[model samples]
Target: MLSWVQKRGTSEHRTGLETPLQGPKQRCWFVWDPMGIIFAIATWALVLSGAWVLVRDLLIPSNNVFYAIANGVVFHLLASLALVSHLRTMLTDPGSVPLGNPPGPDTVSYCPFCLCAIPERVYHCTVCRRCIRKNDHHCPWVNNCVGEDNQKYFLLFTLYVGLMSTHVLLLLAIPVLRSHARGEWNASSTVSLPGPIFFLFLVALMGFIFALVMLCSQMCSIYKDKTTTEMLHQNKHSQGRQSMWANIKAICGPRVSLAWLSPFHSPDRYKVSERHVMA
Candidate 1:
């Protein structure tokens, strides 16, 4: 009876859907994540709306508004370009090169979730559930993984976006500040003067400023040929000593901008050679 019971239990476990067991490997090119998509859309919307307002106000021949708008648009465009470039690299790059023929030994290590072999300087993103080539941390706002391909673009995006947002805030503030100085409103004035719009503008300004500062700091580290992981490790060991500017210049090189835009350096291009890696 004990043997029968044991066999019954084994059979039941095998048939149970809740039981954890390894299944056949399934290959898929793209996996959709709705939350990620939504986040990306929202960020893009903010950028577009800000650009529209700046352009519209400038066209009205309102004091320095055009200059402010142009500055804001340029900055945001640069930043967005950087981020998009980085994200594109990550998505296209194959995780690893498969062993030819009989496949005796697995030459590369891979994360189970993403099913991609880890590349040199790459890391696994827990949130995105993928092994990114030259992986940087996942960016929540962009809803995309940052890796070797898109890193430069991502950096550009951060820098420009920050500059644009800050410029807009200042431009908007000048008129209000000037009016306030002239005692335009009473102390208890309840009159609506685009207050809600201004409040939203302030919120966006603050948010972008914080994001820009953080991204710029990270970009400085990356330019030094260091990952956030490596930076933290070095900091812990060396009491927060940062990499020198010379080191960063060496890694980034003189033609960094050209290299950044070239698709040859992109992770999506399977032909990426060691020459593409920064020193």
Candidate 2:
């Protein structure tokens, strides 16, 4: 672990590098957590199912099933793209670099990994294998450090994923209701085992439900202008309160929407208020 520390009576500071941190076991990569694997599989399943529905509709000419499938696919694609883009931005944003120096007094240089001057509230992530800007803890799900640049995207990803999940749930529920209303299944009808299609729908339903709940909770925390890490840290420190609403407004300013459409934005375009720093 690496850390930045400041001298008590002087402006001079230093960065400290500890023992090397290794990544998760190789098996972890291959057998990703069951939840993650399920989520990934469900995501791909939805995409393939959507495609099948579309192709089937084209071939049959009158099947509405394809239309429903197309809707689900589009919703998933947009949400997934938005979420991924946001995650990418968070992982690569340099600004997230925290504000001091490495551990040794004579070390004139900063850690290339973190890219921050280094001070309090900063730390290195073993997962990212780099010093983080304004270092927050590493998120295993994201497989990256959430620093200054990517914070906004991370928030956006959570928000959009929740919305997307809710949308998918609704979309799937609608067709299911219709099918039941038509009395397509009766006691006399043989109960076929749930196939890939049924399982895909089930997975999507469950994934979105879970994602939506988590996203909503995170959004509430973000709306208050705090990270999960920050919130937890606050419990142990005497830091002042942050105005989350104000931070949100600042990030979502006039040009904020542009973030969704494009990945490369001038840092200058995103104005950081003193209030944002306080948070």
User: What do the candidate models score in CA lDDT, each in turn?
Assistant: 0.50, 0.47
Summarize candidate 2's per-residue lDDT along 159-191 as a digit string, tens digits: 555555566556546766787799986778664
For candidate 1, what is the TM-score? 0.58
TM-score between candidate 2 and the true structure = 0.59
lDDT by residue for model 1 over 1-279, one digit each (tens)? 334434444565465522111123235323256776776667666666655655554434555666656665565665466346434433433232221111111112334454433323546666656555555466666566655545545554565566666666666677778888999878786645455456548645765776677677666665565666556555332122145553333333434366644333532232333312322
In model 1, the clashing pairs are 79-156, 79-157, 80-157, 82-153, 82-154, 83-153, 83-154, 85-150, 86-150, 86-151
> TM-scores for all candidates?
0.58, 0.59
Model 1 alpha-carbon drift over 4 Å, by segment = 1-31, 55-110, 113-120, 180-196, 230-279
Candidate number of the best TM-score: 2
Candidate 1, residue 46: lDDT: 68
Q: C-alpha displacement of 74 in model 2, angstroms?
A: 3.5
By summed lDDT, which 10 consecutive residues of candidate 1 come out lowest? 98-107
How far residue 175's Cα lies from its native spot in candidate 1, in Å, is 2.2
